[model samples]
Target chain A: MWLSRVDWEKIIKHLSILALVEADTARIESLARDLEKIVEMFNKIVELNIPEIVEPLYTTFFGEINLEEDVEWESMGIRELDPTGERLEDGYVKSPKTL
Target chain B: MLPPQCTQFSSISIKTLRERVREDSDFLFKYVEEVYRAIERYEQRLRAYITLRPISEVIDDIENLVKHGKLGPLGGALVAVKDNISTKGIRTTCGSKMLENYVPPYDATAVSRIKNSGGVVIGKTNMDEFAMGSTTENSAFYPTLNPWDYGRVPGGSSGGSAVAVAACEATVSLGSDTGGSIRLPAAYTGIVGLKPTYGLVSRYGLVAYGSSLDQIGPMGRCVEDVAIVLNVISGHDPRDSTSLRVNVENFEKYVVDYPLKRYRVVVLEEMVSEGIDEKVMKIFNSTLDVLAKRDVTVEFRKMPLLHYSLPTYYIIAMAEASSNLARFDGLRYGTRSEAEGKLWVDAYRKTRMTGFGEEVKRRILLGTYVLSEGLYEGYYLKAAKVRRLLHQEFTKLFREYDAALSPTSPTLPPRLGEAIVDPIKLYSLDINTVPINLAGLPAISVPGGFAEGLPVGIQIFGPPLSEGFLLNIAKLIESGRSG
Candidate 1:
C-alpha cells in the first residue's frame, strides 16, 4: 500500500543510528558523504513534485483571473492586508480622472 | 543703504563682518588679499571642518558676488557641510577610513544649492563613520567634542554639524539624520536640528547608509537660521527621484506666521512611560507646562506604533545598511589590503577586516544573515511587513494631530564610555527619534532645558511635507527657554 511504502519509522530509526555514532573523523566524513546523497535525492523529489506545491497556490491567488499588461510598479502604493487576509489595494490605482 | 535686514551680516547675528567678507570678492581682492589667512584665524580652531574649498576659488566667487552686487540670503554667511555629503573636488571622508581619500566628481545637490545662493562653503564637519554611532565617538578618524562641555559627546553622525553651529563656527550647518543623528546631537549641544520631510531635501550626493531612512537636514543656533538654510536647499531636484514634487514654501513663512492657537501639539505618553530618567522627564513636562501657560494648548497622547519603533528600525536599517555597504569590497574605492600573494577571496576578507569597526561589522553580518536566501522570508521580509504597518499607524495619528512630541533622548548624555561596549544600549539611544525616520516624516529637536546641567531636547514630529509647521512649533520652545 502507499501508506506502508512511506516507512516513516524506518527512516527515523536509520537517522537515529547515524546520530548515535561518535563524531570521530571517520564517522564525520562518512556522515558528510551520506548527507550530500540525501540532499541530491531531496532535490530530485522537489523538482519532480513541484506541481503539488505551486499549482494550488496559483489557483488560490488567481481564482480564474488574468494579469493586466498595462500595470507598472512605480504607480502602486503600499498593498495592505485587510481583515479577510487579502492584499487590499495593489499599491497602485487608476488615476482619479481616468476613473 | 545696507542689503535688506534679512540679508545683512550683523542683522543675521551669526556671521562676523570679516567672516562674511570671505564671500565678498571686493573684500577678498580689493581689501583683504590673503583670505585663507583670515579664515584660519576665524573658523579653523573649532575643528568645524574636515575639508575646505580652495581659497583661490573662494576669492574668485566672493569677487563675483560683490561685483554683481548680488547679496544672497546667506550672502556673506559661512556654512559647514557635514562630512557625509560629497563636495566636488574635495575629500568627503564621512569620518571613516573607507572614504578618507574619496573625492567626488560633482557636488551634492545641497552643496550646489549653497554655492548658487552665494553662501560660502566653509568646510566639512566631523561625524560618526558612515553615520552609524550616536556619540560621534564611532568616527574612525576623531570624535567631535561637544562645544558645551568638550569632555562629552557632541551628539553623533551629525555631531560635527551640531558642534559647528553651537560654537558659532558656522551660522548654519547641514547634518544628515538616519535615526536621530541630527536631533540628538542638536539637543546635547544646545543647537537646533531639523530633519525635513524625507524627500524634502535631495539625497543625490549623500553616501548611502540606509536609503529609506537617511535624510539631510539643517542645524543652526536658532530656528530662523535653519529656515534660511532650508529655503536655499528645499526645492525639488530632478537628480533625486525621491525628491518631492510639491512646491516647498519659504520655511520662514511658517515660523513668522505661526498660528499656535489653531494648532494642537500631542505629547507622546510612551516617551514618558518608563526608563526616562526623572530629571529629563521633568524638564520635558516643564516645557509642556510653559506652552500651556502661553495658551498654546498641549494635549498628552500616546502613539501605539512608536512602542515597536526601535526594534523595527534596527531590523530595517541594518538590513538596508548591510546591502548598501557591500559596495565597499576594497574594489574601485576606499582602503585596499596590502596582504601579499593574496587570493581574491583573502584580499576581500582582509580589506573588510581591517577597514570596518566592530559595530559596523556586526551590523553588516546581521544584515547579511537576514538577507540570505533561507532567512529573508523570516527576518528581512517580516521586518518590512512590520514597517509598513507602522507607517499606516503614523498616517492615522497624523490625521488627528498636527505634530507629535517627545523627549529627543530618553536620557541626558551618558558619561563617556558608559554603555560603549553594550551595542544594544547604544542602538536604543535612538528610541524616540527612529519612528519619525521610519515614517519618513519631518521632525526637529529643540533644546528644552537641562538635566544635571547637561542639555535636554524635546522633539516635534510633523506630517509629511510639513517641515514649516514643525519648525514654527519648535520656535516657541526656542524663545521661551522655560525648562
Candidate 2:
C-alpha cells in the first residue's frame, strides 16, 4: 500500500531532466524497482503530522556567519584553478558551445 | 627498539609515537618506513587507499618539516585521509569516477590543521562515492575489506580510513560522516571513530553530501589515538560558516585523566526493538554488562521519535545531496565526457551520466524528486520538521543523561556482496547512527567485542560540543575488557 502511488518512469524522467543527469536507459525498470523500495522505506515519515510552530531546521549552528570585510582579495592562481593545464587556452577554459 | 621491517602501526598509538618522535628523529624515519612496508604487504588485499603518496615524496616532506623545526604534536605521526577531504595537490577522489583524476587546489581545514600540527598525510583512503552508501562496496574503485574478517566488508563511506588504521596502514585517519559514514566503518573494523558535533570540525573543503549533517571526524586504532587526533583537528575556521565559534581543549587529557565515576547513560528501547542480528544483539548486551561493571548507570527508554529517523534521514540527506552535487557538471572540475563537439547542456548530461556510480545517481534522482514542484512540501519540508522534533527530543534527554548507547550497526559486517543487493537493506543499517547526525550531536564508536570471532562496536552519543566527555566515556569503555 505504501508504494501504490509510485510512477517511477515518469518521476525518473522528470528527475533526469531536472538534474541534467540520466540513468542508463537499458534497464531503467530495475532502477525504478530499487527506487520504489527506498521510497517505500521513506514513506514511513511522509505522513508525519508536525506541530505548526516548528520551523524546518536547516543548518545546525545558531550564530551569525563570520563574514570577512568587503575588500578585493587576490584571485586564485592559474595553477590552482587549472592544475593540469590541458583545459586552459590563453587563461580561459575551452568548452562546448552553449547553443 | 623498533619492531623489524613490519611495524604494526595499529600497536603504536599517536601519543606513544609523538613522545618517541620528539626524542629521536631516526625512530620516526624507521617507523614511517615500517608503515609503508605494512601497506605494501596488505594494501593489495585490502585496497584501503585510492591514492598513496609515493614513499619518496613522504620522506622528503618529513625531512623538510624537521629541517624547518615546524613539526607539531602530530609530528612524524602518519595519517590517512578520506578522499573527499581535499588535500592540496593530492588526488582527492570521493570514490567516484567523476573525480577519478581530480586533484585538489587546497586542503580542507581539517587536513590543513593536521599538517600544521605535524601530522603527515600518508595517502587518501577510499570511500563510498561522495560518501553516499552504507557499505564501501559502492565505491567505483573497489571495496575495502574488513581487517578482522576479510570475507566481510568494512562499513563505509569511511571504510578505507578505518581499514587503514586497523591494518596498521596509518596511525590515524580523517573521515567525514553525514549519515554514520565514519562510525559505521570504525564499528565494522574494530577501531575508534568520532563523528564530532556538527560545526565542531570545519567542512570548508569536504565535498558536500548533506550540508547540515556532514561533519569531518577522526579514526584511530585506539581511543587515546582518536582523542589525540581530535585535539589537533577541532576548532573554528572562518571559511566554514557552520564552524562552531568555540574553543576546543586537548581531548587527549580527558581520556588520560578524567576521573570516571558513575556516569549516567541510557539505551533507547525502540532503536533495537527489531532488525538487529542475533549475534550483534548478544555482543551489545555483553557490552552493557561491561558498562554496568564499570559503575556506569544504564537505563532504557522508548524514544518513539527515533522510530522516524531512518525515513527522515534519507529524505533530508538525499534532498541536500541533490542540491550540493549540482556543481559537478564537469565544466569546471572533475572528469568530463570525451565526446567531441556537443551543446553545453548535452555535455553536462553526458559527463554526469558517464561519470557517477549507480548509488550516486540514484540519490541524485530521488533528491531531485523530493525538491521538485509540488512534492517539496510533502517530502523535504516534512522530513525537516520531523528532524527539528528529533533534535529537540535529544536536547531534552541530554539534560538528564550524560550519553545514550547503541550497537553501532544493527548487524555485523555482511559479506562483501550481501548488503548492496537491496537498497533498503543497506539503508536500514544506519538506523542507530543517522538520528545522531540529524540531531547534530557528537558520537563515537569504540571496539565493543567479538561476536562469533568478528568485531562489534558500541556507539556512544553526547550532546553538542560534548566531544571531550564522549572521549572520556569512550576511554572508560575502551579500558574495560569483555568476559
Candidate 3:
C-alpha cells in the first residue's frame, strides 16, 4: 500500500524526525516511495518462520566482553572535545539560542 | 629510470613490493612515483580518491622510514584507505558533506597499525555517505565509476578502494565491510577483498554503520596481497571494546607454500538458483570447477533461512545506524546548520537535512521507525531472532563443511544510475554476502572470472575466526588463475 502524505507526516512526527519531513514535496514523495519499498521488503522478515524457542542473537561471536578498569587517563581538553574546533568560553560548546 | 619490476603496480603483489623495497631502498620511491602517475592518469575517470596526499608527503614518509630503518612488513607500499577510516590530520569525509572538512586529530587504530608496519597512506578513497548504501552512488560528493566499465558502478560503499586497487591506482587499499561493502565491491572490480571475522580487526576509527557488522579489511589485486595487509592490520586493540583478544596470526604464510588441503565446501543451492545473472552463474559454475580441480570438494547445500538475510540485515543495520548517527548533531566537528537565528532543534533539522544524502535520510527514517515504540518488537526483535537462526544454521553447516561458497553478489555491477532508482533491488544485490556478516563469519571474495566483460567474484566463507583458512582457500583459486 502506498503511504499517503498524511501518513508520512504522522511517521515523521511520531519519530520526532524534522529533516526528512521538511524536504521539498518531490524529495519527500520520493522518500515515501523508497520507504514503501523498504517496508515491503522488510515485510519478508515477518514471513520468516523462525521457531519460537530460539533466542535473538544480538551480538556476534566475540568471546567474553572485557571491561576496562576505571582508571582515568589523559583526556582531550574542551577544545579537542569539540568537533567544530571552536574555543569554549566556559567548558561547554556554544550553540544557537534554543529558547 | 625505474626498474621494470617497480613500474608494474597491478601485476606485482604486495609481498613482492615489500621484498623489493627491503632489498633496495630507492625502489620504494620509484614504485610510489609509478603509483602516483597511474593515479594521475586514472583518478580523473575512476574518481577513486576523496583526498589524494601530495607526492611530497608520501616521499617524506618514505624517506623517514628509510632513515629510521623502520620499513615494516608493508614498507613503501602505497595503500589507499577508505575515507571513512580516520587518518591523523587527513580529511576523512566518509563521502558526506557533514564531515567534508573534518580532519581527524588521530589516526584510526588500523591506520596507525599500517603506518607502524610502514604502509604509506596514498589517499582516502571515496565511499557511500556513512556507508548507508550498496552502491557508491549515495556518496554526497559524487559517485565512483567502475574502472572496468565507466557506465557501471564500482560496487560500494568501498567502491573507491576497490577501484584504486583494480585500476592500479593503489597497490592495496583498506576498506570496511558492513554487509558486503568490501566483498561486493571486490567482486565487481575483480580484486580480492577479505572481511575478516568481526572483532579480528579493531573498529576504533571506522565510522560506525552497523557497528555489529562493521569490519575494516584489506582489498588487493590478489589474495596474497590482501593477506599481507591483513597481517599488518589484524590484532587486538584495547581502544575497541569489541576487539577479540587473540594472537595475530601470520596470514601471509597461509598463502605461500601452503599445502593444499582437500576440504568440503558447499554452495548454497538457494543462492545459486535464482536472481543471479546468467553470465554470472556461468562464471560461478566455472569457479566451482576450478575448486574441484584443486582437490576441494564442492557440493550444493540448501538453507531456507538464507532467503531472509537481506531484510533481517536491513532492520538490524538501520536500527543501529539511527542510534550511532545520532551522535553527529551539528555540535561536533561535522557540518552544522547555517540558518541564522534558529533554535538548536531547528539547527539539527537543517544540518541533517542538508548534510546527509537521500539514501542516508531514508535509512535514518526507516531506522527510527523500526526502533520506535510499538514497532520495535514487531520489526527489530523479529529480525534479531531470525538473525540468531541464521547464525545457528551457519554453525550447523560449518560442522559438516569447511567452508560455504557462493557468488559474492547475485548480479553484475549495476549500470550507473540504474540501482539508485529502485532501492529494494539495490538491497537485494547483497543477498549472497549479508548472511556471512549476520553470522559474523570470515568471508573472502576472490576474483573468480569475468562474465560479459565485467568481473565476477566467488565468495568463500568459513566459521568465525577462520580468516587464515579462508584466505588459503581463496589463494588456491587465485593461484590456479595465474598458473
Best by DockQ: 2
Candidate 2 has which clashing residue pairs, if any?
Answer: B74-B118
| TM-score against native, each model | 0.76, 0.95, 0.94
- The TM-score of chain B in candidate 2 is 0.96
In candidate 1, what are the lDDT values of residues A1-99, reduced to their tens digit? Answer: 121222423332333232221122323333334333322322322222122222111000111222235544553223321223243345443221110
Candidate 1: which stretches are off by over 4 Å?
A1-99, B1-47, B52-60, B257-261
Task: Judging by lDDT, tell me the better candidate of 1 and 2.
Answer: 2
DockQ of each candidate, alpha-carbon based: 0.02, 0.61, 0.49
Chain A TM-score, cand. 3: 0.60
lDDT of 1 at B267: 78
Kindly list the per-residue Cα lDDT of model 2 for residues B242-349, writing each as its tens digit.
Answer: 788887887877784343556899899976778888888887888788778777889998889888999899999999999999999888878888545467878888
Tens-digit lDDT track of model 1 for B1-483: 111112222223333444545564454343223334433553443355677666676666666777786647776556788998988767898887877877676799999888788677767888888888888888887667765565677778798888766765555789999889999999888778999887788888999888888889888777878887889888677777677766878787766534544677787788777688888889898888766665676777766656666766776777788778877766667777764544655555556666776556555655554566764655555555556666767778788888888899888876667645456567778888988887788899988887666788889897788888788778877777833
TM-scores of chain A across candidates: 0.26, 0.69, 0.60
Give a tens-digit lDDT track for model 3, residues B1-483: 111222455457777887887687788788877888877777887798999999999999989988998887886788899999999878999999989888888899999999999889989999999987778988988889987789999998899999888888888999999899999999998889999998999999989999999999999888888888999898888888889999988888788534357789998899898788888998888877877787888888788887788899999999998888887767766887775545677777777777877778778888988887877877999999998888889889999989988999989999999987898888888989898889999999998888777888999999988888888888878776666
Supply the TM-score for candidate 2. Answer: 0.95
Interface RMSD of each: 18.3, 2.2, 2.8
Q: After TM-score superposition, what is the CA distance of residue B82 in candidate 2 from its true location, in Å? A: 0.6
Docking class of 3: acceptable
